[model samples]
Target: MVPAERRTMSPALRRTLVIAILVELAVGGWLLASRVLRVPPALPADMVDDPLLAAEIRALASRADRGGTPEWRTLGEGLLGQGAYAHAESAFARAAALAPQDIDALFGQAFCIDRTGRMAASNPLYRRCLDLPDRTEDGVGRKPFALYAIGRNLLRLDDVQGAEAAFRENASFLPAQFQLAKLLVRDGRLGEAVRIVDDLLRQLPLALELHQLKARILEAAGAPAEAFLARAMEERSAHLVESNFSTDYVRPFTTRLGMPRVLQEVESRLPPVPGDPRRDPAVLEREIQPLEALVAEARVPQRATLAFLRGALAADVDDVAGITAALGIVDAAGDRSASRLELEALVRDRMGDAVTATALRERAAAMAPSPQLHRRLAEESERRGDHAAARHHRARADFHLGKAAYRRNRLEDALREFREAAVHDDRHVATWYRTGEMAYHLGRRTEAVEAFRRVVDLEPDHER
Candidate 1:
């Protein structure tokens, strides 16, 4: 019989094997129970007043009443309360699907999605709720919260113009005056923003946020003394918001002066040139006198900035001597590297010192090769017919400009710039090849072929 099989079937051995298997099975079952049977805690007693979400939750409750898992609702509410926004979103989505018309579930889903940083997804849902004909009259169409959400989202995306329009539309519906004040502050209407915040603080003296907003607005409006007082009040109110307040943890309010207004002021104070004859010399001197006086009285940073501005104005007027004088002032002030370099470049350029200008530009490039500066150098080199220098500068400029142009669908211009850039730097073989591909898309067959051939020569194995 094929080497008589050893009959090793002992009862004790079989019993031990069976017991081990049973223990494993018991452990696995416990693990499964732990994973699938654990229930989430209950929601807070006070329900959120968001009607759309509330209705959706009610529908989910109805589904639970119909013998669906009560665990689903519990999980969703628990996730929402604990700020587990993403988890809450999925749970609420399931709850909403199970009971579509449940306003609570829908609102919960939207709220969770919004809080989870899914503005693109949440916006449409919020809009859909607002568009519904059967929406409740509890200010559904005119709800400040919904409007604020949309506005805040737009602001976060840097869609300032859109945010301004939305905020204006919903200004009347906002529950707190502070919200409107903050929006105004964001819009650069510091005076109005401050007025609104002041009104709110009169009613709610404990509103530290309102006080801080007022302080920021006042500072932006140039009322430094009043701003400091308001900041003091804000610190006092901080203790009420939370005990054991620490200054290090507190967010200091910021003041942002409007760029356009600052530019306008700088422009207005610029000294007039003699050759322009556009305005009276006396009038120009009078206009600039106040600026000079202000410069003397200003803080170090502001004085340095003003000195740079004056240098720029002098260069604009072809006043080489004046430019040099202003640059000296800036240098004496110190701690204005950017302004110093900028003024130096301007003066050098104005004085027809191309070599000096190039040196300064190279230094600036090494420091910070901003696209504007690169383009300036490129254009200047091109004007002087220095093709090699132009090519180098253009390559630098194109590195930045190409992406911006591509984003704006100016493919032809981008292709041209990339091609020119490739000609400037043979080491950028990949960029050269990409230029050919872009040229092909732009229908420049001859240019594309030349670019491709160049790439092929650079790298024999390069695939077209």
Candidate 2:
């Protein structure tokens, strides 16, 4: 963890401070010149506009001055909610001085400090808050939110492992898990991200974001059909009017001459495999050759993806030169996405430059903060014997590619993308609604109804 003295202020905090400084500058020195020593702090009208909150602050201040029981803690909490962090911190400090054992005062103080961009200084107070005795139910001895603050602070410090540990310490806290998942994805450890999100979904089945995340993971893992199913669930969970498209296991196409149908036509013309045909490498290569040739001959920009696919086929056949040639074409076509980086890393790895390969992989992983990337990074890092880094980068990827598919109105492709996105971010109500709409359009009433039910469950006020 970064020590307070060594930790640099975050950009957001710096920006906030700069804005405040600029406002003070604009107001000139009159305010500062008029200030008195120990001037009684007044509530900012915008923050303490509500009558009840204003009254509560006034009452607490009066009680504190009279040496009454420390109702100042309650006032602190009210001020904190109103974004009056400085006043809240003072109130909490007073309450703590009056009642040393008041855990709420310690937590409130730490929370206020943290919110005011003094995270490093707040660390010790957080520890003190958590160390207090358990007075609430759940018997954890500390408020779960304390762990959340600790996790967020650790994350800001780039202490990925520490953040993960803190987040896992309080499993019921959703934001911690989400943060951990993001770190995992950024590090390219998709499998672990999937497991974390999957477990969370079991508890929060109606969470649209989680489902969307899972879908994205599936897509990154090359499970298009599974992604499609996930998208269906996500769409069904949305609050929008659902579509009626049936879920199909086909890539979306602009023309009626869709890839799936075209592939079927080509398959009918090819010689049948005698045994386990799908596993026949030679046959697969032969089948893919025509597509490769077509892609090479085509002048269309979108066909660049076909070149990348051909590179994958070459890799499967251990055709290093073929992979290089195909990838070179993709590069020449000006593709620089995470997928392109991943392919470059793979080729470098194959060429026996382990160091360069690993670096490239890391770069690719960093470029795409997805579950799939993290999973791939984990695999690569584990291969290089860096289990800790591998473990840290194991979150799921999102279904951006699938969303692209969806945008083209390629119902089947869109469904797959939405499903993949939902897997990673199940709380994505939009995806769930789209899935339901598509399912309904395809006359899959049962599936549509199930998806619609999820939507209703997620958003009780959702219109059908």
Q: Write the per-residue lDDT of candidate 1 for residues 182-234, one digit (tens) a residue.
A: 66787698878776666666666656677777778888888998887676555
User: How high is each candidate's TM-score?
Assistant: 0.36, 0.42
The top-ranked prediction according to lDDT is: 2
lDDT of 2 at 146: 73
lDDT of 1 at 196: 66
Model 1, 447: alpha-carbon shift in Å? Answer: 8.8
What is each predicted model's overall lDDT from 0 to 1? 0.62, 0.65
Residue-wise C-alpha lDDT for candidate 2, range 193-300, written one tens digit per residue: 888878877776656567687788888878888877677667434322111111110112111222333455555644343344563657666767766554445444
